[model samples]
Target: MTANTLVNSKLVCVALNDKAQLAALEGTFNEAPYKKPPTQPVLYYKPRNTWSVDGAEVEWAKDFDGNDVAEMVVGASLGVVIGKETCRVSAADALDYVGGYTVVADYSLPEQSYYRPDIKGKCLDTSAPVGPEIVAADKVATPDSLSVAIKVNGEQKSAFDLANMERSIAELISTISRIMTLQPGEIIAVGFAGDRVAVAKGDKVEASIEGVGTLTNTLGGA
Candidate 1:
Protein backbone atom coordinates (compact mmCIF):
# COMPACT_ATOMS: atom_id res chain seq x y z
CA MET A 1 0.00 0.00 0.00
CA THR A 2 1.37 3.35 -0.94
CA ALA A 3 1.67 5.92 1.81
CA ASN A 4 0.08 3.64 4.42
CA THR A 5 -3.18 3.27 2.47
CA LEU A 6 -4.67 -0.21 2.39
CA VAL A 7 -4.56 -2.16 -0.86
CA ASN A 8 -7.08 -1.13 -3.55
CA SER A 9 -8.18 1.91 -1.62
CA LYS A 10 -9.73 4.99 -3.21
CA LEU A 11 -9.63 8.58 -2.03
CA VAL A 12 -13.12 10.09 -1.78
CA CYS A 13 -13.44 13.81 -1.17
CA VAL A 14 -16.53 15.81 -0.22
CA ALA A 15 -17.28 19.25 -1.63
CA LEU A 16 -19.55 22.14 -0.69
CA ASN A 17 -19.71 20.69 2.82
CA ASP A 18 -19.06 24.03 4.45
CA LYS A 19 -21.33 27.02 4.74
CA ALA A 20 -18.83 29.42 3.23
CA GLN A 21 -18.06 27.24 0.25
CA LEU A 22 -21.72 26.56 -0.30
CA ALA A 23 -22.57 30.22 -0.19
CA ALA A 24 -19.70 30.98 -2.52
CA LEU A 25 -21.15 28.65 -5.10
CA GLU A 26 -24.80 29.36 -4.46
CA GLY A 27 -25.39 31.63 -7.42
CA THR A 28 -23.73 29.26 -9.83
CA PHE A 29 -25.77 26.32 -8.63
CA ASN A 30 -29.03 28.25 -8.79
CA GLU A 31 -28.44 29.22 -12.40
CA ALA A 32 -28.75 27.34 -15.73
CA PRO A 33 -27.95 23.60 -15.68
CA TYR A 34 -28.60 23.41 -11.97
CA LYS A 35 -31.65 25.08 -10.49
CA LYS A 36 -30.82 24.19 -6.91
CA PRO A 37 -28.00 23.30 -4.63
CA PRO A 38 -27.21 19.63 -4.01
CA THR A 39 -29.06 18.14 -1.08
CA GLN A 40 -26.88 15.07 -0.66
CA PRO A 41 -23.15 14.82 -0.10
CA VAL A 42 -21.30 16.08 -3.17
CA LEU A 43 -18.51 13.57 -3.65
CA TYR A 44 -15.43 13.43 -5.88
CA TYR A 45 -12.48 11.11 -6.20
CA LYS A 46 -8.71 11.05 -6.36
CA PRO A 47 -7.91 7.66 -7.75
CA ARG A 48 -4.72 5.70 -7.13
CA ASN A 49 -2.85 7.39 -9.99
CA THR A 50 -3.09 10.72 -8.22
CA TRP A 51 -1.80 9.51 -4.87
CA SER A 52 1.47 11.03 -3.67
CA VAL A 53 3.51 10.27 -0.61
CA ASP A 54 4.49 12.69 2.10
CA GLY A 55 7.60 14.73 1.24
CA ALA A 56 7.25 13.85 -2.43
CA GLU A 57 8.05 16.42 -5.12
CA VAL A 58 4.68 16.76 -6.84
CA GLU A 59 4.35 17.57 -10.51
CA TRP A 60 2.41 20.67 -11.42
CA ALA A 61 -1.26 20.15 -12.40
CA LYS A 62 -2.67 20.72 -15.89
CA ASP A 63 -5.77 22.60 -17.03
CA PHE A 64 -7.93 20.05 -18.72
CA ASP A 65 -10.77 22.57 -18.73
CA GLY A 66 -8.86 24.75 -21.22
CA ASN A 67 -8.56 27.68 -18.82
CA ASP A 68 -4.82 27.05 -18.78
CA VAL A 69 -5.06 27.07 -15.00
CA ALA A 70 -2.63 29.70 -13.83
CA GLU A 71 -2.71 28.45 -10.26
CA MET A 72 -3.90 25.60 -8.07
CA VAL A 73 -5.27 25.21 -4.55
CA VAL A 74 -3.59 23.41 -1.64
CA GLY A 75 -6.69 22.07 0.11
CA ALA A 76 -5.83 21.21 3.68
CA SER A 77 -7.94 18.26 4.79
CA LEU A 78 -8.36 15.50 7.40
CA GLY A 79 -8.60 12.04 5.81
CA VAL A 80 -10.78 9.35 7.42
CA VAL A 81 -9.47 5.87 6.75
CA ILE A 82 -11.96 3.04 6.60
CA GLY A 83 -11.34 -0.03 8.73
CA LYS A 84 -14.00 -2.34 7.30
CA GLU A 85 -16.66 -2.64 4.65
CA THR A 86 -19.32 -0.06 5.40
CA CYS A 87 -22.71 0.34 3.78
CA ARG A 88 -26.02 1.81 4.92
CA VAL A 89 -24.56 2.41 8.36
CA SER A 90 -25.82 4.70 11.07
CA ALA A 91 -24.14 7.95 12.08
CA ALA A 92 -24.04 6.83 15.70
CA ASP A 93 -22.01 3.76 14.73
CA ALA A 94 -19.98 5.20 11.84
CA LEU A 95 -16.86 5.69 13.97
CA ASP A 96 -16.79 1.95 14.65
CA TYR A 97 -15.94 1.41 10.98
CA VAL A 98 -13.21 4.00 10.92
CA GLY A 99 -9.70 2.67 11.23
CA GLY A 100 -7.80 5.90 11.74
CA TYR A 101 -7.11 9.39 10.44
CA THR A 102 -4.44 10.90 8.25
CA VAL A 103 -3.46 14.27 6.88
CA VAL A 104 -4.15 14.94 3.19
CA ALA A 105 -3.22 17.86 0.95
CA ASP A 106 -5.66 17.86 -1.94
CA TYR A 107 -4.16 19.70 -4.92
CA SER A 108 -6.31 20.77 -7.83
CA LEU A 109 -6.68 23.40 -10.52
CA PRO A 110 -9.29 25.84 -9.26
CA GLU A 111 -12.82 24.92 -10.25
CA GLN A 112 -14.65 27.50 -12.27
CA SER A 113 -17.94 25.67 -11.82
CA TYR A 114 -18.62 22.52 -9.82
CA TYR A 115 -20.93 21.05 -12.47
CA ARG A 116 -18.28 18.99 -14.22
CA PRO A 117 -14.85 18.15 -12.85
CA ASP A 118 -11.82 18.58 -15.04
CA ILE A 119 -10.33 15.11 -15.19
CA LYS A 120 -6.68 15.91 -15.81
CA GLY A 121 -6.83 18.90 -13.51
CA LYS A 122 -8.27 16.81 -10.69
CA CYS A 123 -6.55 13.46 -11.25
CA LEU A 124 -3.02 14.33 -12.27
CA ASP A 125 -0.37 12.01 -10.89
CA THR A 126 1.15 13.20 -7.59
CA SER A 127 -1.76 15.55 -7.01
CA ALA A 128 -3.09 14.15 -3.74
CA PRO A 129 -0.33 13.89 -1.10
CA VAL A 130 -1.57 11.69 1.71
CA GLY A 131 -0.34 10.57 5.09
CA PRO A 132 2.66 11.43 7.15
CA GLU A 133 1.11 8.82 9.49
CA ILE A 134 -2.24 7.45 10.56
CA VAL A 135 -3.49 8.11 14.09
CA ALA A 136 -6.00 5.54 15.34
CA ALA A 137 -9.66 6.66 15.39
CA ASP A 138 -9.83 6.42 19.15
CA LYS A 139 -6.93 8.82 19.38
CA VAL A 140 -8.82 11.52 17.48
CA ALA A 141 -11.63 12.19 19.91
CA THR A 142 -12.97 15.16 18.00
CA PRO A 143 -12.42 14.74 14.28
CA ASP A 144 -14.91 17.44 13.36
CA SER A 145 -13.40 20.11 15.56
CA LEU A 146 -9.77 20.01 14.44
CA SER A 147 -7.96 22.91 12.82
CA VAL A 148 -6.31 22.57 9.42
CA ALA A 149 -3.74 24.92 8.01
CA ILE A 150 -1.79 25.44 4.80
CA LYS A 151 1.58 27.12 4.43
CA VAL A 152 3.36 28.18 1.29
CA ASN A 153 7.10 28.74 1.59
CA GLY A 154 6.74 28.85 5.36
CA GLU A 155 4.21 31.68 5.19
CA GLN A 156 0.68 30.98 6.36
CA LYS A 157 -1.62 30.98 3.34
CA SER A 158 -4.89 29.47 4.43
CA ALA A 159 -6.53 28.05 7.54
CA PHE A 160 -9.92 26.58 8.40
CA ASP A 161 -11.53 24.57 11.16
CA LEU A 162 -13.33 21.27 10.72
CA ALA A 163 -16.00 22.76 12.95
CA ASN A 164 -17.10 24.64 9.84
CA MET A 165 -18.21 21.41 8.20
CA GLU A 166 -21.92 21.22 7.44
CA ARG A 167 -21.79 17.48 7.93
CA SER A 168 -19.94 15.87 10.78
CA ILE A 169 -17.60 12.92 10.24
CA ALA A 170 -20.27 10.51 11.40
CA GLU A 171 -22.84 12.05 9.07
CA LEU A 172 -20.57 11.92 6.04
CA ILE A 173 -19.64 8.28 6.61
CA SER A 174 -23.21 7.25 7.28
CA THR A 175 -24.63 9.31 4.44
CA ILE A 176 -21.98 8.35 1.91
CA SER A 177 -22.20 4.68 2.74
CA ARG A 178 -25.78 4.59 1.56
CA ILE A 179 -24.62 5.27 -1.99
CA MET A 180 -21.38 3.32 -2.09
CA THR A 181 -19.81 0.78 0.21
CA LEU A 182 -16.49 2.05 1.53
CA GLN A 183 -13.89 -0.72 1.62
CA PRO A 184 -10.95 -1.28 3.92
CA GLY A 185 -8.16 1.19 3.20
CA GLU A 186 -10.32 3.74 1.34
CA ILE A 187 -10.32 7.29 2.71
CA ILE A 188 -12.95 9.97 3.03
CA ALA A 189 -11.46 13.45 2.82
CA VAL A 190 -13.95 15.45 4.90
CA GLY A 191 -13.26 18.53 2.68
CA PHE A 192 -12.07 22.12 3.18
CA ALA A 193 -13.84 25.42 3.55
CA GLY A 194 -13.68 29.15 2.85
CA ASP A 195 -11.26 30.37 0.22
CA ARG A 196 -8.04 28.67 -0.87
CA VAL A 197 -4.81 30.44 -1.68
CA ALA A 198 -3.38 29.98 -5.15
CA VAL A 199 -0.06 28.17 -5.42
CA ALA A 200 2.60 28.18 -8.09
CA LYS A 201 5.43 25.92 -9.16
CA GLY A 202 8.37 25.35 -6.79
CA ASP A 203 6.34 26.37 -3.77
CA LYS A 204 6.95 24.45 -0.54
CA VAL A 205 3.50 23.48 0.69
CA GLU A 206 2.71 22.12 4.12
CA ALA A 207 -0.73 20.97 5.33
CA SER A 208 -1.03 20.28 9.01
CA ILE A 209 -3.62 19.11 11.54
CA GLU A 210 -2.20 19.64 15.03
CA GLY A 211 -2.20 16.28 16.83
CA VAL A 212 -2.89 14.23 13.72
CA GLY A 213 0.23 14.83 11.52
CA THR A 214 1.64 17.06 8.79
CA LEU A 215 2.15 16.44 5.08
CA THR A 216 4.65 18.47 3.07
CA ASN A 217 5.26 18.59 -0.68
CA THR A 218 6.94 20.74 -3.33
CA LEU A 219 5.20 21.62 -6.59
CA GLY A 220 7.56 20.78 -9.45
CA GLY A 221 8.15 18.88 -12.69
CA ALA A 222 6.11 19.14 -15.89
Candidate 2:
Protein backbone atom coordinates (compact mmCIF):
# COMPACT_ATOMS: atom_id res chain seq x y z
CA MET A 1 0.00 0.00 0.00
CA THR A 2 2.97 2.30 -0.53
CA ALA A 3 3.72 4.42 -3.58
CA ASN A 4 6.84 6.33 -4.66
CA THR A 5 7.76 8.95 -7.27
CA LEU A 6 10.82 10.95 -8.30
CA VAL A 7 11.55 14.46 -7.00
CA ASN A 8 10.45 17.58 -8.90
CA SER A 9 8.59 15.65 -11.56
CA LYS A 10 5.12 16.52 -12.89
CA LEU A 11 4.18 13.08 -14.18
CA VAL A 12 3.61 11.70 -10.67
CA CYS A 13 0.09 12.29 -9.30
CA VAL A 14 -1.01 11.78 -5.71
CA ALA A 15 -4.52 10.37 -5.29
CA LEU A 16 -6.50 13.08 -3.54
CA ASN A 17 -10.25 12.87 -3.08
CA ASP A 18 -12.53 15.48 -4.66
CA LYS A 19 -13.63 17.08 -1.39
CA ALA A 20 -10.02 17.65 -0.35
CA GLN A 21 -9.18 19.41 -3.60
CA LEU A 22 -12.28 21.59 -3.36
CA ALA A 23 -11.49 22.74 0.18
CA ALA A 24 -7.96 23.71 -0.84
CA LEU A 25 -9.20 25.52 -3.94
CA GLU A 26 -11.67 27.47 -1.85
CA GLY A 27 -8.98 28.50 0.62
CA THR A 28 -6.78 29.67 -2.23
CA PHE A 29 -9.56 31.62 -3.91
CA ASN A 30 -10.80 33.30 -0.74
CA GLU A 31 -7.36 34.12 0.63
CA ALA A 32 -6.10 35.72 -2.58
CA PRO A 33 -5.41 39.44 -2.20
CA TYR A 34 -7.45 40.20 -5.30
CA LYS A 35 -10.57 38.71 -3.62
CA LYS A 36 -11.77 37.39 -6.93
CA PRO A 37 -12.91 33.80 -7.26
CA PRO A 38 -11.19 31.61 -9.77
CA THR A 39 -13.08 31.42 -13.06
CA GLN A 40 -11.36 28.07 -13.59
CA PRO A 41 -10.61 25.25 -11.16
CA VAL A 42 -7.09 24.86 -9.76
CA LEU A 43 -5.34 21.55 -9.19
CA TYR A 44 -1.97 20.59 -7.62
CA TYR A 45 -0.28 17.24 -8.21
CA LYS A 46 2.09 15.71 -5.65
CA PRO A 47 4.97 13.48 -6.73
CA ARG A 48 4.66 9.73 -6.22
CA ASN A 49 7.53 9.60 -3.74
CA THR A 50 5.25 11.49 -1.38
CA TRP A 51 3.14 8.42 -0.63
CA SER A 52 3.57 6.64 2.73
CA VAL A 53 1.62 3.62 3.89
CA ASP A 54 -0.51 3.70 7.02
CA GLY A 55 1.43 3.46 10.31
CA ALA A 56 4.77 3.86 8.49
CA GLU A 57 7.31 6.04 10.22
CA VAL A 58 7.99 9.51 8.69
CA GLU A 59 11.61 10.61 8.60
CA TRP A 60 12.71 14.19 9.20
CA ALA A 61 15.70 14.93 7.03
CA LYS A 62 18.47 17.11 8.38
CA ASP A 63 18.63 20.73 7.24
CA PHE A 64 20.76 20.59 4.15
CA ASP A 65 22.23 23.59 2.37
CA GLY A 66 19.60 25.07 -0.01
CA ASN A 67 16.87 23.36 2.04
CA ASP A 68 15.06 25.46 4.59
CA VAL A 69 14.53 23.81 7.95
CA ALA A 70 11.01 24.11 9.29
CA GLU A 71 8.24 22.09 10.95
CA MET A 72 5.98 20.43 8.41
CA VAL A 73 2.23 19.90 8.80
CA VAL A 74 0.81 16.43 9.37
CA GLY A 75 -2.25 17.20 7.20
CA ALA A 76 -5.10 14.73 7.29
CA SER A 77 -7.19 15.07 4.14
CA LEU A 78 -10.13 13.05 2.77
CA GLY A 79 -9.21 11.38 -0.51
CA VAL A 80 -11.65 10.34 -3.25
CA VAL A 81 -10.81 7.85 -5.98
CA ILE A 82 -12.42 8.56 -9.33
CA GLY A 83 -14.33 5.68 -10.90
CA LYS A 84 -14.95 7.09 -14.35
CA GLU A 85 -13.77 9.71 -16.81
CA THR A 86 -15.68 12.81 -15.94
CA CYS A 87 -15.61 16.09 -17.84
CA ARG A 88 -17.71 19.08 -16.94
CA VAL A 89 -20.17 16.86 -15.07
CA SER A 90 -23.07 18.31 -13.14
CA ALA A 91 -23.21 18.29 -9.36
CA ALA A 92 -26.00 15.79 -9.48
CA ASP A 93 -23.76 13.50 -11.46
CA ALA A 94 -20.58 14.12 -9.50
CA LEU A 95 -20.86 11.30 -6.97
CA ASP A 96 -21.48 8.85 -9.77
CA TYR A 97 -17.91 9.26 -10.95
CA VAL A 98 -16.42 8.82 -7.50
CA GLY A 99 -15.24 5.30 -6.77
CA GLY A 100 -14.70 5.67 -3.03
CA TYR A 101 -13.11 7.69 -0.24
CA THR A 102 -10.05 7.16 1.98
CA VAL A 103 -8.11 8.95 4.68
CA VAL A 104 -4.77 10.58 3.68
CA ALA A 105 -2.15 12.44 5.62
CA ASP A 106 -0.68 15.14 3.35
CA TYR A 107 2.59 15.99 5.11
CA SER A 108 3.51 19.58 4.31
CA LEU A 109 6.85 21.21 4.96
CA PRO A 110 5.85 24.49 3.46
CA GLU A 111 8.80 26.47 2.11
CA GLN A 112 6.50 29.35 1.27
CA SER A 113 2.87 30.36 1.19
CA TYR A 114 0.51 29.06 -1.48
CA TYR A 115 1.60 31.96 -3.70
CA ARG A 116 5.22 30.77 -3.79
CA PRO A 117 6.69 27.51 -5.15
CA ASP A 118 7.10 24.57 -2.70
CA ILE A 119 8.14 21.56 -4.73
CA LYS A 120 11.02 20.34 -2.56
CA GLY A 121 9.35 20.79 0.82
CA LYS A 122 6.16 19.05 -0.27
CA CYS A 123 7.46 16.31 -2.59
CA LEU A 124 9.90 14.70 -0.22
CA ASP A 125 9.79 10.93 0.33
CA THR A 126 7.15 9.64 2.78
CA SER A 127 5.44 13.02 2.69
CA ALA A 128 1.99 11.52 1.96
CA PRO A 129 0.54 8.76 4.19
CA VAL A 130 -2.71 7.27 2.89
CA GLY A 131 -4.97 4.40 3.80
CA PRO A 132 -6.94 2.63 6.52
CA GLU A 133 -9.79 1.84 4.13
CA ILE A 134 -11.68 3.09 1.10
CA VAL A 135 -15.25 3.96 1.96
CA ALA A 136 -17.62 4.01 -0.96
CA ALA A 137 -18.83 7.42 -2.04
CA ASP A 138 -22.44 6.35 -1.49
CA LYS A 139 -21.60 5.61 2.13
CA VAL A 140 -21.35 9.33 2.73
CA ALA A 141 -24.30 11.12 1.20
CA THR A 142 -23.18 14.69 1.80
CA PRO A 143 -19.45 14.81 1.29
CA ASP A 144 -19.30 18.58 1.60
CA SER A 145 -21.15 18.58 4.91
CA LEU A 146 -18.69 16.54 6.96
CA SER A 147 -16.50 17.69 9.87
CA VAL A 148 -12.70 17.40 9.92
CA ALA A 149 -9.99 17.77 12.56
CA ILE A 150 -6.36 16.99 13.35
CA LYS A 151 -4.89 15.77 16.63
CA VAL A 152 -1.35 15.40 17.89
CA ASN A 153 -0.76 12.98 20.77
CA GLY A 154 -4.53 13.11 21.48
CA GLU A 155 -4.54 16.93 21.69
CA GLN A 156 -6.75 18.74 19.22
CA LYS A 157 -4.57 20.85 16.92
CA SER A 158 -6.91 21.69 14.02
CA ALA A 159 -10.65 21.53 13.42
CA PHE A 160 -13.10 22.82 10.83
CA ASP A 161 -16.48 22.19 9.26
CA LEU A 162 -16.59 21.43 5.59
CA ALA A 163 -19.18 24.17 5.39
CA ASN A 164 -16.31 26.55 6.06
CA MET A 165 -15.10 25.82 2.57
CA GLU A 166 -15.91 28.72 0.25
CA ARG A 167 -16.35 26.57 -2.85
CA SER A 168 -18.70 23.59 -3.03
CA ILE A 169 -17.40 20.15 -4.01
CA ALA A 170 -19.57 20.01 -7.13
CA GLU A 171 -18.34 23.37 -8.31
CA LEU A 172 -14.71 22.34 -7.89
CA ILE A 173 -15.22 19.08 -9.77
CA SER A 174 -17.10 20.73 -12.58
CA THR A 175 -14.53 23.47 -12.80
CA ILE A 176 -11.51 21.16 -12.72
CA SER A 177 -13.02 18.77 -15.25
CA ARG A 178 -13.48 21.56 -17.76
CA ILE A 179 -9.72 22.01 -17.72
CA MET A 180 -8.71 18.32 -17.67
CA THR A 181 -10.38 14.94 -17.71
CA LEU A 182 -10.52 13.21 -14.30
CA GLN A 183 -9.65 9.53 -14.48
CA PRO A 184 -10.63 6.65 -12.21
CA GLY A 185 -8.44 6.28 -9.05
CA GLU A 186 -6.86 9.74 -9.37
CA ILE A 187 -6.81 11.66 -6.04
CA ILE A 188 -7.55 15.27 -5.07
CA ALA A 189 -6.38 16.41 -1.59
CA VAL A 190 -8.22 19.21 0.16
CA GLY A 191 -5.85 21.78 1.77
CA PHE A 192 -5.15 22.53 5.44
CA ALA A 193 -5.72 25.67 7.53
CA GLY A 194 -3.62 27.99 9.75
CA ASP A 195 0.14 27.68 10.27
CA ARG A 196 1.31 24.04 10.56
CA VAL A 197 3.27 23.00 13.62
CA ALA A 198 6.57 21.14 13.65
CA VAL A 199 6.48 17.41 14.36
CA ALA A 200 9.47 15.50 15.77
CA LYS A 201 10.23 11.80 15.92
CA GLY A 202 7.81 9.69 18.02
CA ASP A 203 5.01 12.23 17.60
CA LYS A 204 1.67 10.53 16.94
CA VAL A 205 -0.47 12.26 14.28
CA GLU A 206 -4.15 11.79 13.63
CA ALA A 207 -6.49 13.25 11.03
CA SER A 208 -10.21 12.59 11.46
CA ILE A 209 -13.24 13.35 9.35
CA GLU A 210 -16.77 12.88 10.69
CA GLY A 211 -17.81 10.23 8.21
CA VAL A 212 -14.51 9.03 6.75
CA GLY A 213 -12.76 8.21 10.05
CA THR A 214 -9.21 8.92 11.25
CA LEU A 215 -5.77 8.16 9.79
CA THR A 216 -2.86 7.88 12.21
CA ASN A 217 0.92 7.78 11.77
CA THR A 218 4.11 8.34 13.77
CA LEU A 219 7.07 10.59 12.98
CA GLY A 220 10.73 9.56 12.99
CA GLY A 221 14.03 11.41 12.80
CA ALA A 222 16.20 10.90 9.75
Task: Highest lDDT: give the candidate number.
Answer: 1
Superposition error at 219 for model 1 (Å): 0.5
* 1-222 per-residue lDDT for model 2 (tens digits): 154411112222222233444455565657666265444433566667677666777766546684435566665656766767878898767777877777667676743544544676677777777666677888988887776688888899877565655556666666666767887767665444433555766789887887787777888763
What would the TM-score be for candidate 2 when compared with the true structure? 0.78
Per-candidate total of colliding backbone pairs: 0, 11
Give the TM-score of each candidate.
0.92, 0.78
lDDT of 2 at 160: 57
Residue pairs with clashing backbones, model 1: none
Can you write out model 1's per-residue Cα lDDT over 24-69, one digit (the tens) per residue? 7788888878789899888889888888788888777655574445
Q: In lDDT terms, how accurate is model 1? A: 0.83
